[model samples]
Target chain A: MSVEPLNNELINNELIKYESIGISFGNRKVLSGFNLTVKKNQKILLRGKSGVGKTTLLKMLLGFTKPSEGTLYFRNRVIDSKTCWEARKEIAYVVQDTDLGEGKVKNLLGEIFSYRANKEKLDSEKLWTFMRELELEDNILEKNFQELSGGEKQRVGILIALLLNRNIYLLDEATSALDAKLKKKVADYFLAREDWTLLIVSHDKEWERDWMRIIDLETQSW
Target chain B: MPIYDISYTSLIFCFFLLIIPIFISRKIRLELEKSTLEAVFRMSIQLFFAGLFLNFIFNLNNGLLNLAWVGLMIFFASYTAIKSADLNVKKLFLPIIISIAFSNLVILLYVNKFVINLENLLDARYLIPIAGMLLGNALRGNVVGIGDFYNDIKRNENRYLYSLSIGAGRYEAVIPYLRKSLRAAIKPTLANIYSIGIVSLPGMMTGQILGGASPLIAIKYQITIMVAIYVSTLLSTTLSILTSFGTAFDDYGLVNKELYEKSS
Candidate 1:
């Protein structure tokens, strides 16, 4: 996992902004009148009950889903179809459902790093170090991802995001399946970076830390 | 000697065999009684008109007319392919038509000129019959290929979306599905080619042999046509998907849910 050195100069610049953003399915309003601003070198936790639009709100930044009402800005530019594709290159997103792909774990990792946007191969030394830290065996890469246990799958997802080395991360329930100890370890690793911009959605109590400010999504409901 | 024509009485004898299915459906509660009769009726009527029109076209022997007939056949094949595959006709019509016409026409003309050594590549007798065989086989292949491809993607949609989420463009993300559907679409034809003489005498070769051609001559035609069908099928299915992809999804890489025909 690559930890980009802290950029004190970028700490105050806005990395993402949501202006009265709202999303709905046909007529059922899920979220509305929501406003949020995330600056560089900030870590924010989204806390909400099930189906209250935490994941949907995070997906809007990646252009996976659109806000039915209000606008979203990334790096001072309005998010649109063209910009969304560009945004994906800079922002690493780990879906709530950690479906990496169906083949071997190492092959999946290989394919992800091979993407033109990835820019570098996976660091094997870092991989082994992180795998040991996350309780994944050296031979785990040989196993099929679909066959891995749920907690193992979550750790792999976290490993890939860190490997991507992007400054911005949108993680949706990324550590929900892990046990308490592993959850605390994963949380601590993410919380260690001072330059990474994290927008995380989780119910895990381990993420409730002093540095990671929590935004109760239920209170922001339309 | 040229093949002898069956008299009208012999035609009656052949139609009589269809009664067995009609009776069996009635006795076994298969509920296929109406469909069995309707299918046979439709087949006979369609073939009767087809025979009459073909007889006229053959006698005229006009190249333009022969090509026009082939164009019409491709249109019907593509139409059947899309409709039976449960896709919206308007959404996929142009691509399927272009794929069917381009692949079948190229293969049919090439076989006539290079394999059969026909001086008149557009000779009505040779072109019309051979094009008909190729179009029929392609129609079946496209139905299975295009049909199975879309359905498989829709079925494993989460897997596809997951790939897209991992920074893959639409083409890169669809590679797995394309590989799978192409394998499925081409397998039956490959089996047909592999087991040619041992498993069963192919219909085209059997028909030619019955029409007084030597076995060697018939087998040669069978070999060329099998190769043509295989290549045409591979191209048609691949092209159909590629071209359809242009309009099948939105810019955000989501499949347009409206592309599927719900009533079907």
Candidate 2:
């Protein structure tokens, strides 16, 4: 019947959508009238100048920042205070500055894994594999997180995202401190996963790929 | 033996001791002369009133009146704690007042009943001063605990949000900060416990000795009071932080920014 196709179309696969989004600090409008739609397994690299609200856009999905105007949707449901908490459980967010407080890296990771939703997610075998792939030595986990080099700290953020095993990734300048080779390796690692949805805000050119869809906020219509 | 009282002339001699500190402040350019004089003046006036008020309360010794005075102390203790912690006093006052009252009253009665074995349990001499000591210590603990907890979360907000994003419930994410703040709050009390007898004679023990009690009895009282102070401080600080959680954080688990007093 004709109704079957219509119902199939209505079963929307859009995982995240931002409609007419606007953000302002005081009188300055950092972002205005922006729109974006991300389908399942979509890889989006948001490109914009510094202070253009790319990070704010990513944080809006997690309810860290509220939009001054318009609506944001996750799985076709409006992302409010309640739904945002549920959305956070499914998204792995790697902040630009990874400050895990004053503690040994091992203990910090243990604390994260101890969360109810994150329980039993700490796979030591997978941790070692990711550490080796990220070029982090075994002894690095013993060092204080605050004392690690910028690149090491950034990788730690990335490592946490990987360890979370969530499908949706929000990377805000996550690889800025890494070298070119590691950047490409990290980019490739994330891009190779066809089932993962990535919303990346990075300035590195290594993330540019043939299959990736880039949204340049500077040039996009407001 | 009878307790000796300082005469008005002897108290004047006590006021004269300030001249030495005033001279030292002047020589060292510590700029404390005015504050030193003002502090001495204020202490004299405040203690003068407190002595008179306490004298009247002790003579009456009505159970209700003694409890009422303790209640007033708890109210002021809560007010000063929030104000000193640099939080919005109006927002935090209710929870803090309740917490201070609950923790101090429970410990105070427990000490009076079980330790001292007081039949009246509301004797002004035992109740008011013990309440003062417990409330005073708990007030300091709450200031350090509540202030550090909120400030730490605000300062390390990204780390907190990272935990939240990784599927941490609000309580789970805050547990780290809670552990840290509680430790900081109790550390001073712990240090005092360790250094109490050797480094200094605590005020209560000194008072008892001055009031013609044996050193042995004074030490016993000092030990008991120190233990009581430590336990009540921990209780109040923990309770203050836990009770304020509902108001201090929004529904999204983010700290309520308005609860923080704007830095002037």
Candidate 3:
């Protein structure tokens, strides 16, 4: 508990580790004895069917859900409410449901970037460029988020996560609603960031590239 | 001039007026007759006993006993607020009680000591009636405030998690919700304040006027009580929602599902 966070000078390799994590909803077992180790800059895809707890796994990183069984570690330390707070600063999680906020898209993004940790990281230029890459019109930012198209909302969710300037990401079906070409485009954009570690949960085949490690959670039955 | 007391015969004539609403409900198929009757009967019994008991308490006017009566009011207010919201009272009782009691008591004392300038702050006439006005409004505020807050959080849970994942502290993540609920809570009170004289004569003003006070004095009491109700409500509803945070969520900042009463 007294251990100080490791200095930035050292080689900080380990990113996240799930050691024997398990959870159950009533008597039904969802995930049990789940184990995984994620290292820095290692792009990984988590593949599983619906309701099999793939999203739950990503949520664990942000302390959105607690494991009924084991410990989750970030940077060689156990993840808890406190650690998740710090980890969320460096980790961008784009939920499957991009009903991320209400009101204007620009305002939503503005609020997110207004947090103390992300205050300096709000770059309008970068946001516009990302929007342009995602084929989102400038007017979309002025539009109400609840009124946006599903694909447009997905892109916005991904766009905000990318703009957070974080090195780690957890994307839960983050690109599912996009069309084929746009899926490839979005997948390519994330993959191009070599230093960014990604834990992606998607049924879309666009992300099934050779370079990214795919962990089919179905096979492991975590 | 003093008001005339209604004889039992006059009161019976008043009961005859209830037939209009009952007949209208039956004619229009409004299905409100049973509820209307129940409400009338309940109010009649409640007020009759409350009048008798308050008369006794006013004559006695013991400080500790008066405080105990106010405590009972606070407990009932909290219970009704939580129960009306269909929440598990076990989880919310203490927080709501503490909040309502603290806010109502604080304002009640302030009104007695500072506003009314009474020598005996616990004088039953001032204390009981003033506390009732404050607690009644606070009750409405809590029902809206805490209820709206938790309901919004439950419905749009993903929105909350989205805020959390954006590197927001718990307070920061929950601020939007707090703002939203607080706005919902204060709206009725503000509207009441706004249209106090034009739209309707408030009960306090009417009661004071009928009780033989000068209209000017009645209006003054109305003004002070309105301000008191608004202040107490703001404090109580805000306090209830804030203090509920102690139990509403776990250490992870996720709302405890157990806090809500499960549907039958």
Identify the candidate with maximal lDDT. 2
Regarding lDDT, does 2 or 3 come out ahead?
2
lDDT per residue for candidate 2 within B1-264, as digits (tens), equals 888899999998998999899999999999999999998899989999999999999999999999999999999999889988888888788888999999999999999999999999999999999999999899999999999999999888888888888888989989999999999999999999999989999999889999999999999888889999999999999999999998888878899888887533
**Candidate 3 off by > 4 Å:** A1-12, B21-39, B262-264
Candidate 1, A1-222: lDDT as tens digits? 233434433533888999999989789998889999998878899888888788888788877788999999998788887787778778878765687767999887887777776647488888888889889988999999999998888788778877777789888888888888888988888878888888888888777788667898788632
Sorted on DockQ, best first, the list reads: 2, 3, 1
The DockQ assigned to candidate 2 is 0.80
Interface RMSD of each: 1.8, 0.9, 1.3
The model with the greatest DockQ is 2
**Tens digit of lDDT per residue, candidate 3, span A11-92?**
3677899999887777888878889889898888888777778888888888888888999999988889778888888898
User: Stretches of candidate 2 above 4 Å error?
Assistant: A1-12, B26-31
For model 3, give the RMSD to the true fold: 3.4
* Winner by lDDT between candidate 3 and candidate 1: 3
- Which stretches of model 1 miss by more than 4 angstroms? A1-12, B261-264
Worst 10 residues of 1 chain B by lDDT: B157-166
B1-264 per-residue lDDT for model 3 (tens digits) = 878898868988888899999999999999999999899889989999999999999999999899999999888988999888877788888999999999999889998899889999999999898888888889999998988898898888888888888888878888888999999999999999999999999898898888899989999888999999999999999999999998988888888898777433
Q: What is the interface RMSD of candidate 1, in Å?
A: 1.8
